[model samples]
Target: MKTFLILSFFALAVSALPLEESERINGENGWYLPQEDGSFEWVDMDVAEKWMEAQEQLESRGLTTVPVKFYLYTSSNPTKGTKITTTTNSIDASNFNAANPTRFVIHGWTQSYTASMNKDICSAWLSRGDYNVIVVDWSRARSVDYATSVMAVGATGKKVAAMINFLQSNYGMSLDNLYVIGHSLGAHVAGYAGKNTNGQVHTIVGLDPALPLFSYNKPNKRLNANDAWYVESIQTNGGSLGFLKPIGKGAFYPNGGQSQPGCGWDLTGSCSHGRSTIYYAEAVSVDNFGSIKCGDYQDAVSKECGSTYSGVRMGADTNAYMVDGDFYVPVNSEAPFGMIN
Candidate 1:
């Protein structure tokens, strides 16, 4: 009778602990926000509430008008970006090449063309190949309140779609060669652009798509597989600043997708969240960001991928054919983050 009572107590204690122990990267803790699909994600309550209020305001007042500007970069002019407009022969006037692969790098809230996301990605693409890198500068929408920036996603996305349409119609740039990459709030902007374009965009890469206001949002509102022909995501700060679950056909969870290595004691998860873009930028230049397919996020968190499952590259050269599951890729704490095969 004593043995039975002790066993029951032990079982209860184990059950009380967090389900996935591997997810607690960087030693961060927070409220567990329940997802629509009955799953729960750890999120900072303050940030979550701000986004929730923003979403509510957005639903009530509709999307706000945002002034979006485009800047083009190429190998010829890597540093100096040529301003491009949707109207009046801007593509023909600028150094826009329709033959090369085109990449649109959209920055997150409080970021502009000068942000590392735009500069580093542009430099990486140029170093890899002669690509057309267009930096979407929507800093005009930024305000003191982060919620106001959330409301501007829709309008900014429409402008991006309009620019895409203008390029396709007038400059003969094929959607097959287009890739839209966005980080944080910009990820949702990419989704909106893809939706506006009727999901005709070739690929959309979401780097740690913001979770605060977007975790419980509908597929049409957030970044999802239906947003593009091939949609993928790299979750660095999942369950906090970033969405916890797989938001795309190909979802990558590096270091459990919660906190990243080298980002020690990240209470707000900004360091880990920024790692998404950093990893992606490096992946664009190097072919070593390898990832193994997993049965689910649980498998990823445990680093015990099924041998039957195949591995795929987690960057610019990701396999479009092998998708539809979670992928786990280990990285170093510092530079040369990709692990050798």
Candidate 2:
């Protein structure tokens, strides 16, 4: 009887653990570190080792499990309770409405649930639609190496998939009404989540997915058309921080995909790169940004996307097409970036 009781206790303990043990990277050198000023600094073995030690110390209280948080927001109370919480078991699924669509918003590197584009996304969705918005905040897992975050997000994706499975099993959630929106590195994370799920995520919208070390990577390594039923990639800064190649069913190249207007001749591409999420956020509220189907970027630059001049809407109202293609739109210097004139 004692042995059986111990076994039951062990199982309970295992079930209570967080999603950390699955994040193991094989043959990774772990030498990359992101700078505070949006640059990168290569590290020696000692520095990398110390960084790893510090990260380990932070997560030591939970043994091998790392903390990942999910914040729930709906139209009833759109603007509160965004604090990081690990109490997944206590989630009042009452905050959710199965009749409405659910959107999982994942953020990029060094981003928090309350900060960065996740906040904009959550607010825009709540205001625009009667939807269930889940902001995934993994600020607890800190890694200096960008490669390590990349690898770790792969594991995180599987855990997210498991969460999807749970919702489906318990609350009768529909995969067809589910969508994932991610920016930069979070874009790839969304892909991994869709890949791990039971193959019916409605769509994944990637806002300028990170380009460094991920542009030419394998399909499974980064996000691709196969990640979801429909994938839309909006590239604001191409051939630099954002992916150059069109990696989705509908690839949007605002102002020919690079060097946005009114950036004040910026070379760092920071303003241009960040415009993707801005455009997406705007689209959520208003998807009237006239997007034209283009054969190539040159066609967009020359104001020519085939003989027909009719342009299609690009963001939340885009036509869900299964075929692959490139798209274009004119740009201005400020808010309401996508323009027809």
Candidate 3:
């Protein structure tokens, strides 16, 4: 029965394939479907029902607003978090010192404040230095189909921008000291937040931004280089669940940006997709995985990049933004995966 449901879902999804040229622009080539071995294959579609379904789900509304919550985690209170809202005095009462660097971590679909990605990343930043780490919870908007959640990204991002603006107005937090990181769908949410901000956020790190409905989305609808002063995208499951084409100023294709080293035979593409966050978490505290500049995505996939000499470092290092380039970084199949030399 479970297998039947799964097959039925895919069948429905498959039937909805190949968006119209008038509706979407970037994926004129074709649609890529996930394979059992964590790879993707281009497929053709004859129907527009699924696309219409997505449109109807969003009702053609410009911005699909949804409820959002924020949690503050600081070195003073690592495990326990203080809930923050625009109306409450939480920010002033909590350890939210605007004088310190502030980082906002947003989770992807089906994720909550307790998601491991949030905990791991929040803990990582706290371990590195004294900073205000806030986890954005948009789960109320995510308990739906992927298409609907995709539609809600812009509205959710506006709320995030409002929160940042609130902090700036009340707590005097400068956008210069702010950094936002998000994974998958949340990556796009981070992008939306950056776009809606009063001024550009200092940096934004997108962990394998979702590919499905966003593949052909306009710059404002998805994470792009212009989302922040320094935007970086780490592609782990590219051409599958993650975006294949680089969208940020600095794009890192670790292990060709497809199937990761440790995620063997990832059927759902979750392992490879999730690795972006783990790699980033490790990069924050452990190593600054190094990478060599690539001429293009093809060069990275073919391993044509010579070596890591005079290369750039990947992960939470703010200094990496000094140069803009696409890079190919090798990763180990185990923990401490940052191939830092």
Candidate 4:
């Protein structure tokens, strides 16, 4: 009887501990906002701007508008929550409306500061093109040795949930038509956000999602998809920074799981572990690779034993697909006939 009682007590005690205590620590090296004293702040707008500017410069070159919002959070208070600016002139999502305009949510790895800053720049550029953007900042610990082991991916996951709840409860925006983009470790953070939303997100684009530490190796409960139907698509180029394939069940790698030609261990060179938007856009464009066509060739030596090799032959003739006209219009009468890029 005493043994049974002791066992029961032990089990209860184990169960009482927070689930975070049991899971493996993930995203320890992630960024966070530093406090005034250079410790750690929940959200930092100053640092975020740097990341945002880099993204804006890249998007500007292509003349594509990318709406974004930057949210920052402290490491110690992952659930403390942060504010989101909207078109309604209100931080409250309830006041948001369809006519108010659509917004994109961008998150950073571990820390929300960098993500928020990046989103701000992206949003500024996109807003110039008339798209409203918002950043969802939440608290998350800074990347440190001890923090890495004790921190849980769930910490960021919970913050994402809070952001979604705010959107749903306050704004009427449907999860569908919502798009999310994350870079590096931010990719896994975005994945967790998408998973907890229960299929509300229409598309999720992971740019070189962090490997090994925070990947899709775990079971596919709600975080993974088998095809483009559920999660739309997962595009990767020069991934595998630390983890190995298959990152997820349906994770797509156009480069055959190999880093780009010039990528190196230090992440310099061609790979550089940068965004794959250009590569992704290229893969989808039929003009770049020609339409998929199949050609059959039987073994000449052994006609009895037939073998076929499918090939995609180009449509012949270079320069046949060149366009001769400029592709830009003035944003306003003040700037007449302005170039897009």
Query: Which residue pairs come into collision in candidate 2?
Result: none
**Judged by TM-score relative to the true structure, which candidate is superior, 1 or 4?**
1
Q: For every model shown, what is its TM-score relative to the native structure?
A: 0.81, 0.77, 0.85, 0.46
Better of 1 and 3 by lDDT: 3
Writing each residue's lDDT as its tens digit, candidate 1 over 1-341 gives 22443344334434444435555431133344323333445534334444455444644575444788999999888999999998667777788888988999999876788998788889989998788999999974455344456667877888899999888887788898799999998999999999887339989999999875564446776889888888999999877778878888889988878889999987667789899999998988886677878889878877788544355778746566657779998889999998756
Local accuracy of candidate 2 as per-residue lDDT tens digits, 1-341? 22433344334434543224333221122122344466754333333444444444433443334356777788886877443232344444347666788889888776777765777878888877798788887652354435446545666676677777777766677888788888877888888898998757889998888765453446877889888889988888776667767878888888878768888776667778778888888888767567677886566545577545345666754456533577777667788766753
Off by over 4 Å in 3: 1-65
Model 4: number of backbone collisions: 22
Q: What is the TM-score (0 to 1) of candidate 2? A: 0.77
User: How high is the lDDT of residue 288 in model 2?
Assistant: 55
lDDT of 1: 0.77
> Between 3 and 4, whose TM-score is larger?
3
Cα-based lDDT at residue 127, candidate 4: 33
Ranking by lDDT: 3, 1, 2, 4
lDDT of each residue in 74-123, candidate 3, tens digit only: 99999888998885466667888889999999998777889999999999
